[model samples]
Target: MINMKETINHYLAAWNEKTATAVKAAFQKCCTPDVTYTDRNAPTYTEEGGFVIKGIDLLTALVMGSHAKVPGRAFSLLTMPQYFDGHCHYSWGLHIPGQDEKAGWDYIVYNEQNLITRIVGFLPEQV
Candidate 1:
Protein backbone atom coordinates (compact mmCIF):
# COMPACT_ATOMS: atom_id res chain seq x y z
CA MET A 1 0.00 0.00 0.00
CA ILE A 2 1.53 3.29 -1.16
CA ASN A 3 1.12 6.41 0.91
CA MET A 4 -0.46 8.49 -1.84
CA LYS A 5 -0.17 11.81 -0.07
CA GLU A 6 3.53 11.37 0.68
CA THR A 7 4.23 10.26 -2.86
CA ILE A 8 2.49 13.29 -4.34
CA ASN A 9 4.25 15.66 -1.97
CA HIS A 10 7.65 14.18 -2.82
CA TYR A 11 6.97 14.66 -6.52
CA LEU A 12 6.05 18.30 -6.00
CA ALA A 13 9.03 18.77 -3.70
CA ALA A 14 11.34 17.81 -6.54
CA TRP A 15 9.97 20.68 -8.59
CA ASN A 16 10.21 23.15 -5.73
CA GLU A 17 13.82 22.45 -4.79
CA LYS A 18 15.91 25.61 -4.74
CA THR A 19 19.31 24.21 -5.63
CA ALA A 20 20.56 21.77 -8.24
CA THR A 21 21.80 19.34 -5.61
CA ALA A 22 18.54 19.53 -3.72
CA VAL A 23 16.43 18.99 -6.81
CA LYS A 24 18.56 16.06 -7.94
CA ALA A 25 18.39 14.50 -4.51
CA ALA A 26 14.66 14.98 -4.36
CA PHE A 27 14.24 13.28 -7.74
CA GLN A 28 16.48 10.41 -6.67
CA LYS A 29 14.31 9.83 -3.67
CA CYS A 30 11.04 9.60 -5.57
CA CYS A 31 11.84 8.56 -9.15
CA THR A 32 13.49 5.66 -10.89
CA PRO A 33 16.64 6.10 -12.97
CA ASP A 34 14.66 5.71 -16.19
CA VAL A 35 11.58 7.65 -15.22
CA THR A 36 9.67 9.13 -18.13
CA TYR A 37 8.16 12.60 -17.81
CA THR A 38 6.10 14.47 -20.35
CA ASP A 39 4.08 17.64 -20.15
CA ARG A 40 1.65 19.08 -22.72
CA ASN A 41 3.32 22.51 -22.62
CA ALA A 42 6.92 21.33 -22.58
CA PRO A 43 9.31 23.13 -24.92
CA THR A 44 10.86 20.00 -26.36
CA TYR A 45 8.56 17.85 -28.48
CA THR A 46 9.17 14.75 -30.55
CA GLU A 47 8.04 13.91 -34.09
CA GLU A 48 5.89 11.21 -32.56
CA GLY A 49 3.98 13.96 -30.69
CA GLY A 50 4.67 15.06 -27.09
CA PHE A 51 7.95 15.90 -25.41
CA VAL A 52 9.36 12.89 -23.63
CA ILE A 53 12.00 13.25 -20.93
CA LYS A 54 13.69 10.12 -19.73
CA GLY A 55 15.95 9.52 -16.73
CA ILE A 56 16.84 11.50 -13.61
CA ASP A 57 19.51 13.83 -15.04
CA LEU A 58 17.10 15.24 -17.61
CA LEU A 59 14.38 15.48 -14.99
CA THR A 60 16.67 17.51 -12.74
CA ALA A 61 17.60 19.82 -15.59
CA LEU A 62 13.94 20.34 -16.45
CA VAL A 63 13.03 21.42 -12.96
CA MET A 64 16.14 23.60 -12.59
CA GLY A 65 15.29 25.38 -15.82
CA SER A 66 11.78 25.93 -14.60
CA HIS A 67 13.20 27.44 -11.41
CA ALA A 68 15.35 29.82 -13.43
CA LYS A 69 12.33 30.91 -15.45
CA VAL A 70 9.85 31.30 -12.60
CA PRO A 71 12.11 31.83 -9.53
CA GLY A 72 10.65 31.17 -6.10
CA ARG A 73 7.59 29.50 -7.48
CA ALA A 74 6.01 26.80 -5.33
CA PHE A 75 3.72 24.00 -6.49
CA SER A 76 0.86 22.89 -4.26
CA LEU A 77 -1.83 20.30 -4.67
CA LEU A 78 -5.30 21.68 -5.47
CA THR A 79 -7.14 18.44 -4.76
CA MET A 80 -6.64 15.21 -2.87
CA PRO A 81 -4.66 12.69 -4.85
CA GLN A 82 -6.50 9.61 -5.99
CA TYR A 83 -4.62 6.38 -6.49
CA PHE A 84 -5.42 3.13 -8.21
CA ASP A 85 -3.05 0.22 -8.49
CA GLY A 86 0.34 1.70 -9.46
CA HIS A 87 -0.99 5.02 -10.80
CA CYS A 88 -2.21 8.28 -9.26
CA HIS A 89 -3.93 11.48 -10.39
CA TYR A 90 -4.08 14.94 -8.87
CA SER A 91 -4.41 18.62 -9.71
CA TRP A 92 -1.76 21.17 -8.76
CA GLY A 93 -1.09 24.90 -8.89
CA LEU A 94 1.64 27.47 -8.71
CA HIS A 95 1.62 29.67 -5.64
CA ILE A 96 0.48 32.96 -7.07
CA PRO A 97 -0.64 35.80 -4.87
CA GLY A 98 -4.35 36.14 -4.25
CA GLN A 99 -5.23 33.46 -6.73
CA ASP A 100 -6.41 29.90 -6.31
CA GLU A 101 -5.38 28.84 -9.77
CA LYS A 102 -5.70 25.14 -10.44
CA ALA A 103 -2.96 25.03 -13.02
CA GLY A 104 -3.10 21.46 -14.23
CA TRP A 105 -3.28 17.74 -13.61
CA ASP A 106 -0.53 15.16 -13.32
CA TYR A 107 -0.99 11.45 -13.79
CA ILE A 108 1.79 9.46 -12.16
CA VAL A 109 2.77 5.83 -12.45
CA TYR A 110 4.97 4.19 -9.88
CA ASN A 111 6.86 0.93 -9.85
CA GLU A 112 6.44 -1.83 -7.30
CA GLN A 113 9.58 -0.56 -5.58
CA ASN A 114 7.67 2.64 -4.78
CA LEU A 115 9.58 4.77 -7.23
CA ILE A 116 7.86 6.90 -9.79
CA THR A 117 8.27 5.41 -13.25
CA ARG A 118 6.43 8.00 -15.31
CA ILE A 119 4.46 11.22 -15.18
CA VAL A 120 1.99 12.55 -17.73
CA GLY A 121 1.12 16.18 -17.24
CA PHE A 122 -1.68 18.25 -18.75
CA LEU A 123 -1.86 22.01 -18.53
CA PRO A 124 -4.95 23.53 -20.10
CA GLU A 125 -3.69 27.14 -19.81
CA GLN A 126 -0.27 28.59 -19.21
CA VAL A 127 0.40 30.33 -15.95
Candidate 2:
Protein backbone atom coordinates (compact mmCIF):
# COMPACT_ATOMS: atom_id res chain seq x y z
CA MET A 1 0.00 0.00 0.00
CA ILE A 2 1.06 3.57 -0.66
CA ASN A 3 2.27 5.79 2.15
CA MET A 4 -0.36 8.45 1.69
CA LYS A 5 1.12 11.02 4.04
CA GLU A 6 4.56 10.85 2.51
CA THR A 7 3.17 11.10 -0.97
CA ILE A 8 1.02 14.06 -0.11
CA ASN A 9 3.83 15.86 1.62
CA HIS A 10 6.16 15.32 -1.30
CA TYR A 11 3.63 16.65 -3.73
CA LEU A 12 2.83 19.67 -1.59
CA ALA A 13 6.46 20.41 -1.02
CA ALA A 14 6.96 20.59 -4.76
CA TRP A 15 4.07 23.03 -5.11
CA ASN A 16 5.34 25.06 -2.21
CA GLU A 17 8.49 25.65 -4.20
CA LYS A 18 6.34 27.81 -6.48
CA THR A 19 8.30 27.08 -9.63
CA ALA A 20 7.45 25.26 -12.80
CA THR A 21 10.59 23.16 -12.65
CA ALA A 22 9.79 22.15 -9.11
CA VAL A 23 6.27 21.12 -10.03
CA LYS A 24 7.53 19.07 -12.95
CA ALA A 25 10.12 17.39 -10.80
CA ALA A 26 7.51 16.52 -8.25
CA PHE A 27 5.29 15.03 -10.90
CA GLN A 28 8.14 12.96 -12.20
CA LYS A 29 8.81 11.70 -8.73
CA CYS A 30 5.26 10.87 -7.66
CA CYS A 31 2.87 10.90 -10.57
CA THR A 32 2.18 8.73 -13.58
CA PRO A 33 3.20 10.05 -16.94
CA ASP A 34 -0.39 10.02 -18.11
CA VAL A 35 -1.73 11.77 -15.06
CA THR A 36 -4.96 13.62 -15.43
CA TYR A 37 -5.38 16.91 -13.58
CA THR A 38 -8.55 18.95 -13.45
CA ASP A 39 -9.02 22.37 -11.91
CA ARG A 40 -12.64 23.37 -11.59
CA ASN A 41 -11.89 27.06 -11.28
CA ALA A 42 -9.22 27.28 -13.93
CA PRO A 43 -9.18 30.51 -15.88
CA THR A 44 -11.28 30.63 -19.03
CA TYR A 45 -8.15 31.04 -21.08
CA THR A 46 -7.25 27.45 -20.32
CA GLU A 47 -8.76 24.45 -22.03
CA GLU A 48 -12.51 24.35 -22.67
CA GLY A 49 -14.78 24.27 -19.60
CA GLY A 50 -12.03 25.25 -17.24
CA PHE A 51 -8.90 23.10 -17.38
CA VAL A 52 -8.42 19.43 -17.86
CA ILE A 53 -4.79 18.49 -18.33
CA LYS A 54 -3.79 15.06 -19.53
CA GLY A 55 -0.24 13.80 -19.70
CA ILE A 56 2.81 15.24 -18.02
CA ASP A 57 3.76 17.74 -20.72
CA LEU A 58 0.43 19.54 -20.62
CA LEU A 59 0.39 19.39 -16.85
CA THR A 60 3.78 21.04 -16.75
CA ALA A 61 2.67 23.74 -19.14
CA LEU A 62 -0.40 24.47 -17.07
CA VAL A 63 1.60 24.75 -13.88
CA MET A 64 4.22 26.90 -15.56
CA GLY A 65 1.57 29.26 -16.83
CA SER A 66 0.05 29.53 -13.39
CA HIS A 67 3.39 30.31 -11.82
CA ALA A 68 4.04 32.92 -14.46
CA LYS A 69 0.71 34.56 -13.73
CA VAL A 70 1.45 34.87 -10.04
CA PRO A 71 5.09 35.09 -9.33
CA GLY A 72 6.04 34.57 -5.68
CA ARG A 73 2.89 32.69 -4.80
CA ALA A 74 3.34 29.84 -2.35
CA PHE A 75 1.27 26.78 -1.59
CA SER A 76 0.72 25.18 1.78
CA LEU A 77 -1.16 22.22 3.11
CA LEU A 78 -3.88 23.19 5.53
CA THR A 79 -4.72 19.71 6.80
CA MET A 80 -3.39 16.21 6.80
CA PRO A 81 -4.37 14.26 3.73
CA GLN A 82 -6.69 11.30 4.12
CA TYR A 83 -6.71 8.25 1.93
CA PHE A 84 -8.98 5.30 1.43
CA ASP A 85 -9.31 2.72 -1.28
CA GLY A 86 -6.64 4.28 -3.46
CA HIS A 87 -8.17 7.74 -3.21
CA CYS A 88 -6.79 10.65 -1.24
CA HIS A 89 -8.19 14.02 -0.25
CA TYR A 90 -6.37 17.05 1.07
CA SER A 91 -6.95 20.72 1.78
CA TRP A 92 -4.47 23.36 0.77
CA GLY A 93 -4.13 27.06 0.17
CA LEU A 94 -2.17 29.53 -1.86
CA HIS A 95 -0.47 32.58 -0.40
CA ILE A 96 -0.01 35.30 -2.95
CA PRO A 97 1.86 38.47 -2.37
CA GLY A 98 -0.48 41.33 -1.46
CA GLN A 99 -3.55 39.13 -1.70
CA ASP A 100 -5.70 37.06 0.61
CA GLU A 101 -4.98 33.37 0.71
CA LYS A 102 -7.00 31.16 -1.59
CA ALA A 103 -7.89 27.71 -0.30
CA GLY A 104 -9.08 24.58 -1.98
CA TRP A 105 -9.16 20.83 -1.75
CA ASP A 106 -8.00 18.15 -4.12
CA TYR A 107 -9.29 14.64 -4.52
CA ILE A 108 -6.64 12.35 -5.93
CA VAL A 109 -6.70 8.84 -7.26
CA TYR A 110 -3.59 6.74 -7.15
CA ASN A 111 -2.63 3.89 -9.36
CA GLU A 112 -1.63 0.48 -8.08
CA GLN A 113 1.99 1.49 -8.43
CA ASN A 114 1.44 4.07 -5.70
CA LEU A 115 1.73 6.96 -8.14
CA ILE A 116 -0.92 9.61 -8.53
CA THR A 117 -2.95 9.06 -11.67
CA ARG A 118 -5.61 11.70 -11.38
CA ILE A 119 -6.44 14.80 -9.37
CA VAL A 120 -9.56 16.93 -9.19
CA GLY A 121 -9.50 20.31 -7.51
CA PHE A 122 -12.47 21.95 -5.77
CA LEU A 123 -12.78 25.54 -4.72
CA PRO A 124 -15.47 27.49 -2.91
CA GLU A 125 -18.30 28.71 -5.05
CA GLN A 126 -17.97 32.28 -6.22
CA VAL A 127 -20.59 34.77 -5.14
| Residue-wise C-alpha lDDT for candidate 1, range 1-127, written one tens digit per residue | 2587787788899888888799888888888899999886456422334488888888887787777676677888888989878988999988754656547889999877668899999875755
- Find the number of clashing residue pairs for candidate 1: 0
Clash count, one per candidate: 0, 0
Model 2, residue 89: C-alpha shift (Å): 0.3
Task: Extract clashing residue pairs from model 2.
Answer: none
* CA deviation > 4 Å runs, candidate 1: 44-50, 97-100
TM-score of 1: 0.85
**Residue runs of model 2 more than 4 Å from their true location after superposition:** 43-50, 124-127
Candidate 2: 10-residue stretch with minimal lDDT: 41-50
Index of the highest-lDDT prediction:
1
Superposition TM-score, candidate 2 onto the true structure? 0.83
Alpha-carbon lDDT of model 1: 0.80
What is each predicted model's overall lDDT from 0 to 1? 0.80, 0.76
TM-score per model over all chains: 0.85, 0.83
User: What's the lDDT for candidate 2?
Assistant: 0.76
